[model samples]
Target: MTKQIEESYQLAKQRYAEIGVDTEQVLADLEKVKLSIHSWQGDDIHGFLFPNQELTGGIGVSGNYPGVATTPDQLSNDLSKALSLIPGKHKVQLHAIYAVTDQPKDLDQLEPSDFKYWVDWAKKEGVGLDMNGTFFSHPMLKDGFTLASPDKEVRDFWIEHGKRSRAIANYFGEELGQQSVNNFWIPDGYKDNPIDKLTPRLRLIDSLDEIIKQPYAEKNTIEAFEGKLFGTGVESYTVGSHEFYANYALTREKLWTIDAGHFHPTEDVSDKFSAFTPFGKGLMLHVSRPVRWDSDHVVILDDALIRMMRSLVRDDLLGQTNIGLDFFDATINRIAAWVIGTRATQKALLMGMLAPIKHLKEVEINHDLTERLMLTEELKSYPFGAVWDEFCVRNNVPVGTEWLKEVQTYEKDVLLKR
Candidate 1:
């Protein structure tokens, strides 16, 4: 099988080379792209801090697939298994609530010491770490609001949480030798049309300004704001709309996260990448599949994903973006969900990298309309899969459906017992 994969890769490499695409270099480049794999998927967003508490602030993980990790160690174990199947060393994204500590702490009281277990685990696994403030699923979520709460006390608690999250993120970067993206996503919005919308937004802006008041080293941390159109409960009004953060990120010189599932079903987030990256400091992309609303489904090799990745490779916006996966599917095997989504994203990226983007752009520049259309359609038929298989092989991961067997075996041996 190895010999066959190598032979197939050689043929695919020759085909790509003929069209001015360097298959070897593409492999090398793709390997270096470290995606921030969100850890919530391993445990359905139910962090150890409040495992029994009902998920609040409009957050919900559907389906009751058994074997969800109940502890921090279990979550990390699942993540390790998923990372093994996925090619390339990557970063693991953590929320503030996932801190593995014997000492009890709230969001505001969290310190770098709380995440000592994670940092040690990351070093052993040879992966970097990313961080997020868990704004939802807590007692502080008063009346479906957090940072935008009318009550100053409620707002203050979350503000401290945000600050703590940044501190921890900076620590991760310092300890692991890579800048951590401290992403802020507050579940602050109105469930129905309120009489006044302006006050909440004003409060949110002030809360954000306070959280970022203390400057952290840019090399150690990159702060980003994520805005959602609406959520399950906050379907009527989202406080931090896309427009709000677009301006905020630009003015503050911060990264704006473009979550694929946070927009309308018909519209995808690919176009936003081109529009935002040109003006803002950079972007943090949350890759997920949205079925109808902002439903965080597992990613697939669909046209939306292909276009998103193609835009990055074609326009060379990768360096200005921090890639991350954001989806939770409790309906399937948790480990398999992580492996599937991450691998699908990598495959889409590989598809984009294998394209003769320069050749297509040259024709477009020359106004050779017919040729540009023909070549793009022709690329779909190319042996990109063979090249992708080679990528997995070279990285010492299972090719094609081989990884699924390992996942199933793991489920029977390790997960089912839990």
Candidate 2:
């Protein structure tokens, strides 16, 4: 199989070189791309902080496929398995609730010390870290509003949590030598059309301003804001619309997150990347799959994903983007979910990187649209999969469905035991 992979890769490389696409450089560049894989998928986001709390704020992780991680060691073990299967060294994204500690601490009172377990693990594994403020599934999420809540106390609780999250992200960066991207996503909105919408947006702006008032070194931690179109309950109006965060990110000089699932079904996030890149600080993409709305299904190598990744590669926006996976589907084996989604994302990126984009762009610039369309359509049938297989082999992971066997073995020997 190894020989077969190398043989196919050699032919594929020759094919790409014929079209002026350097497969070697593409692999090297793709290997440098590190995705921030979300940790909540292993345990459905019911972190150690409040294991019994009912998930709220319109977030849902369906399916009861057994062997959900019940402890820090288990989640870390699951993540380790995932890392081994994935091709490149990547960052692990953690929410505030995933803090590993013996002493109990509320979200508002969380300190960097509480997450020592993760930092230590990251050091041992040689992976980077990213942070998130969990705005859902908390008691303080009063009236389905947090940062934008009319109630002052409710707003205060989340504000403190946000501040603490930044400190933790800074600590992660300091420990791991990578700028921890601290993403803020609040589930604050109204299910029914509100009588007054302006007030909530105003309050949210002020709360966010307060949270980011005390600055940290940009090298240690970068801040971002994510806004959703609508959720299960908040179907009518979401306070943090794309427009809201677009302007906010521009003015505040913060990364604006673009979650693929956070937009209307008809809207494609790929188009916005170019529009935002010229003005905003940068982008943090939550590569996800949405069936009809924000369903948070596992990502697949679909057309939308292809376009988004191609846009990034073609526009040369990779350096200005923080790529991350954000999907939680408990219906399947949790470990397999990570492998499939992450691998699919990598495949999309690989396809994009392999495209003869320079030639295509030149043709377009010369007003040769017909030739541009011809090459692009013909390029789709190229042997990029051979190159992708070689990438996995070089990275020392399974090249194909062979990785599934390892995941199945882990499920039987480790997960089912729980």
Candidate 3:
């Protein structure tokens, strides 16, 4: 078994070498990672998912950015042609949330034909779909969901669609189950000053509870909340990491989705992952490169900070993963962008896979090294790190001169540097 493992490692080293990874350093790092990660086998987290509509180039859609806006007729044809190009069991998301179709009164206006068409596209392409909510539609939700019009009728309008979406998922069945109508990215909170308007946020959370507890929210249907730090208003409900957890705490039904670019503009990616660990909630990580304050969604992986995050999630140190490509690359082909993002993400994971074997030089900094891993006092105060560290030490992790030096140096100097 050891020989077979060594052979596999050698094969992986060769593959990395071919992909421009420094194989010698990576192989050495792989040894350390193996020691650190041995007991983490049998984990259910595996594979990836991309948006099917993204695979379709501008020719077949009606929405915004990258692709040209077309009528539904043109969108249908474009989507059909685009579906033919995809390969494998990739996770896809519905771009229909941005639809400005004729359905202002009813959000369920996106019927079985709409969903079934996407599913069929995925079926033909051998892919799966990850559904997300829309903000532009529902006419009444122009400002945001939680704080849109502050009118009960408007809130109910959105909620009614939530029910319709669940029903559509039922009609579509397993295909939809493979992904989910992932929600709770509620545009709650206020603009101007960060005060006032607490009821809307609470209402949004309650609405999420109803959505998740309904018949559609199954084990297969993993509902997720994308915690946005900004965009909707000055004070969003799920902005800070704690707020995200608090929202989830309301009901133990669903998990939290982490968008790497959604924190305070200067927030570290590694720190973000640490915040979500206390709940040990299954994470849905969105992979995208931020251009300055704006989310460019470029596919470049040069930033070491983002790469370190890639490593942590790949290592499962952050727990069960549901990583997705959240790019909105405007210049390139969307399919190519998705592929590039996935490839870069895989590369980062490979680097992390090599971390257990790398040296871990003992440092005498002012604070404990693990202190850096703590996102909040709550997560650090919890027993999470102790259990994780115990697992590492039992495996005889090296005490000094580690290759993570490369990772840390790169992250600190190149990636995190503003």
Candidate 4:
């Protein structure tokens, strides 16, 4: 595109080549890496389910940003705007609550027809679709549990809902020609200390077994279970803790979903990737920013995120990981939030790909600890920005902060009206 940017990329490419990194192949691989952008960010997690249905089940959104999508059409349109501003082809991850229907129906009653509009939209946009079972913000979760509820009736209802979600995910995969990931994350825990922690986990195991008993084509769907450290009300205990889900996923041969915000502040999710890869079938990552706790702030290009991306690349686990965003920040422009998070993720991946991993690995194997440490720190100051700007230019997106002007224009003409 711009002559100056192209010249800069050539210099950066030669510099990276000296380090045994192929810039062309890295950019090609980055183009193929698809990040599933969450739909909730466009609407502040308010799906078109019911009137006055507040967010419950231990999670909550914390702003009153205008132009929140209240209808399915609006949500789709807003997502399209955000996708256009980001690089590479991507997918939209949808919650079951976002289902558009003509008739009144509950979560268990939802079918692929209710999501036919999404399929049509995905087809038109040349994108894939992923689904999630909405286990929160409903009357069913009033007791702060769903699949792990002691009451058989409540547990059975959620079981049926999970089954339906799998079916929908299968349909999405079949229709879009990409395996749709159906992730299960339920808020089933106690705010205060409880004596019956074992019971709920046992019940959850049975419920999950029952839900998965109904077979769907494996090629069309990937079932994953997400765990939480704690939540708004579920402070004392979370039944779906990391230890529980990690063990269950390994035993059951399912994908393990790791939300960055769903762990202790000091914990690094990147460390868990290698540990889970050996036993688990695959990994699902919910990239989010957590401030002190599971605050679900909008993701920015931070140190932890860059490290996680580098780990995935270094370990060669990118192909086995289903990456998606899971933050809902209504404090700023919603569409801008989506663009910022998605681009930041891509940037991190680019930096990871540009790293001299092979050289560093050789140094480690040779027991040259001093060179290894020095090279690691030295690579950080490389011209990653030049290559990244070239990436944006090659993908036909705005370079640097140029995208912000488009977002501001959209906010003035589109978002402010609401």
* Residue 65 of model 3, lDDT score: 30
User: Ranking by lDDT, best first?
Assistant: 2, 1, 4, 3
Which has the greatest lDDT?
A: 2
Model 4 worst lDDT window (10 residues): 44-53
Pick by TM-score: 2 or 4, better one: 2
Ranking by TM-score: 2, 1, 4, 3
**Residue 127 in model 4: lDDT:** 97
User: TM-scores across all candidates?
Assistant: 0.99, 0.99, 0.62, 0.98
TM-score of 4: 0.98
Q: 377, model 1: CA deviation in Å? A: 0.4
| lDDT (Cα, 0-100) at 53 in candidate 4 | 83
Which wins on lDDT, candidate 1 or candidate 3?
1
lDDT of 1: 0.91
Residue-level lDDT of model 4, residues 1-418, one tens digit each, is 4898999999999999988889999999999999999999988777876636887887688888788888888889899889889999999999998889998789989999889999999999999999999998878885788999988888988999999999999999999999999999999999899998898999999999999887778789989989988888899999999999988888888899999999999998899999889778999999999999888898889999998998999999998999999999888889999999999999999999997888889999999999988877878888888999999998899998899899899888977876
- Tens-digit lDDT string for candidate 1 (1-418): 9999999999999998888889999999999899999999999888877778888887889999989999877888999999999999999999988988787778899999899999999999999999999999898998988998999999999999998999999999999999999999988887889888898899988999999999999899989999988887787898999889988999999999999988888885898888888788999999999888778899999999999998898989999999999999999999999998999999899999988888888899999999998988888999999999999988999999999999999899989999
RMSD of 2: 0.7
How well does candidate 2 score on lDDT at residue 355? 79
